[model samples]
Each structure stands twice: as C-alpha cells, then as structure tokens.
Target: MDLNPKLPTLPAFYQQRIEALLARGSRRLLGLVGAPGAGKSTLAQVLASQWPGQIQVVPMDGFHLANVELDRLGRRQRKGAPDTFDAFGFVALLKRLRTQAVDDVVYAPSYERSLEEGIAGAIAIEANTPLLVVEGNYLLLNDSPWNQVQALLDETWFVDVPQDLRVGRLTQRHQQFGRSAQDAADWVQHTDEPNARRIEAAKAKADVMFRWDS
Candidate 1:
C-alpha cells in the first residue's frame, strides 16, 4: 500500500499513469477526485495541455443544477451538496461517450464559476480522442448519483494536499469570486470542510493516490 515518497507532484505521476492506460488499447476514461481546492481541475488542465487536443477534459461542476433550478428545488443554499448536481444527466453523458466511435464528437457541459451556472456544450470530446479526463470533488462519493460515476471510469485517482493548504486555497478562491474574507473562511470551515471530510474517506476507491507536495 505504500507509494513513492519521492514523487514530486501529482502531475508527474499522472503522466506515467496516462501512458500506461493508453498502452492498453481501450478507450480511456480517467477520473480525478478530490476536495474543492485540492487541485483536481488544475491537474486535468495539465493533462489536457500536455496532450493538446488529443485529451478531452470534462469537469463535474458542469453538471451542477442551474441556479434557477436550485432555487426551484429549494437547494440553492447548499449549492455544492450531492443533491445539487444533475447526476442523471452526467451519467447519461458518460454512458454515451463510453461507446462512441472515433468519428463522433460529444459535447459536454462546463461550469463557469463567474457565471455561477453551467454552460452547455462548452467542451467537446471528439470521437478520435482516445482519452477522457474527468475531474471533480465528488466523483468518488458513495451517495446515490455519485456512486455510479466511478463505475464508468477506467481509473480513478484521488488527489491529496495538506488540509491547511486546501483550506487556504478554497478561501482565496471564494474571495476571488466575490465573497468577503470572513465569508470565505466561514464557508471553507463549515460547508467546504464538511464536504472535504466526506470525500477524504473515499480515497480508498482510487486506483492511485496523488499526494501533492506539502
């Protein structure tokens, strides 16, 4: 169960993992799961950038219910909770993309933080692309909706960073998005932390664990 202690960064490990998966010849679906601010999306972008157009990146935030829908369901306040996302929609997309031919392109949704909503068709995974990297905070969660997500991925990686660093990053991210410092700290400690705790226990589900340098 021990891993290489000298591993420099999560991205370095990811490169090797991707190489091995592609060698196996089956279409690849790589899921990177972590708490908010644990750098899942950043790692996804690293993979996409390194592979250029060949690797497609799909974000879990893309499946979040619209603000209007959240309000309608009276769940807008708990926006990042398990029930806040359109789990069925996300599952359907994953199912379709699994068997899609190389000639077909699948348009995946993306979430815009500034807009606080999802933008449909903002991402495209072409049929010719052989690898799909999906990143999000709840991909490995055990609850309904999220439980099935792991089944669709060829491999799942759990990203781990120092708790202090993760909390700091989340606070800054919230402030950058218009929250006051007090509000940011409060949310990270309360809402984000609780969710992070839930996700921390799911790390065992990952095929690999990428622990970021402290």
Candidate 2:
C-alpha cells in the first residue's frame, strides 16, 4: 500500500506546473506519448490519481481499430501501428473535449484489453473537468492527423525507458493477454519495436521527455 517508497513518484515541479494549468481557469488537455512498453499509461494513471476529480485519463488506445477491421485491412499483424488506429476520429474527439466539457458529459471510448476492442462511451468525462490526461503512443507523431494532436494539447510528456526494459514489459503484457511466449516475443520484435522507433523519434516534439521506469 505504501507506493511512496517503491513507485516512481512524479517530480514536484511537474506537479506544480500542472497546478498552474489548473489555476488558469480554462480546461486543459495534457498528453503523454511514449513507446509501447514505456509506462505511459502507468505514469498517466499516477498523475490522474493524485488530482482525483480534477483530472481524468482519456487514452488514445481507445481509437484502435477493431480486430475485424484490422483483419479486413490486412493490418492485424501490426495492430499497434499508427495506421491501425482511427486517427481522424481521435483528433475529432480531442477537439470536442476542448469545448464539450462545460456543456455536458463528454464521453470517451476505452480500450478493453480482455476483449481486445474499444468500447464506446466507456469513459464519462464529467462536466467542467479541469484537465484531461491523454496517454498514447502517437500523440506527438508528425504524420497527418496524429500530428494535429500536439497543438491541441496544453502540455505533453514523452515517457521513456531503456529498450530492453520496454521489450520485457511488452512481452509480459502480451503473454498475459493469452499470447504464447514465442508469439509475444515475435510480436514485440516484428510489430511493437518498429512502432517504438517512430514514436521515439517524435520525442523532441513533446514539452518534456523523461524516464517512466515502471
């Protein structure tokens, strides 16, 4: 229960900076972009937990194309790749989140890892929620609609860790989701690593880049 000693607690300055954003009296979108196994989700959850009602995570994974659609497009082997997501729809959601927060609940899709699909209206972002912690692998990508995401965010952080650690975590995650050990490793090497390279290349576009070390 004592995460104080074990977890990678966020630095005080980062907390202060987020507080300053909340003080601005306007809704803010904060983005967390990183490689597949780099702990972006973990870091975002930690931050959002600290702020409680003031911050909620709106993940880009929710924009993942369905397994059936990926199969239809012949992209099932590369499910986590940027092209396999609904980039335009994700961008539209981010734009809507900017204004819809005060008028009523702004519902966001959520990725169901067990079912391996995005469930619509899974996250209900409450009215006047002060900040949204958006986490994903491609927010800072310079390609088309994903590129448009950076300008929409009030601030962004690119989470990172050594490649070996990332690969290990990704393999373990895949295995947990019913992948055979060899299949998990193969997926990481052939699929996730290629995407990691592209995501890592865009780190310079983030407001800050740091090790998440989950």
The candidate maximizing lDDT is 2
Worst 10 residues of 1 by lDDT: 1-10
Candidate that scores best on TM-score: 2
Q: In model 2, where do residues sit more than 4 Å from their true spots? A: 1-8
Please give the distance, in angstroms, between residue 171's alpha carbon in candidate 2 and its true position after superposition: 0.5
Q: Which TM-score value belongs to model 1?
A: 0.91
Query: Lowest summed lDDT over 10 consecutive residues: which window, candidate 2?
Result: 1-10
lDDT per residue (tens digit) for residues 96-172 in model 2: 98878456888899999899999999999886788899999999888898889999999998887878777888888
List candidate 1 stretches off by more than 4 Å. 1-13
Over 126-150, each residue of candidate 1 has an lDDT whose tens digit, in order, gives 7878789988888888888778899
The deviation in Å at residue 10 for candidate 1 is: 6.3
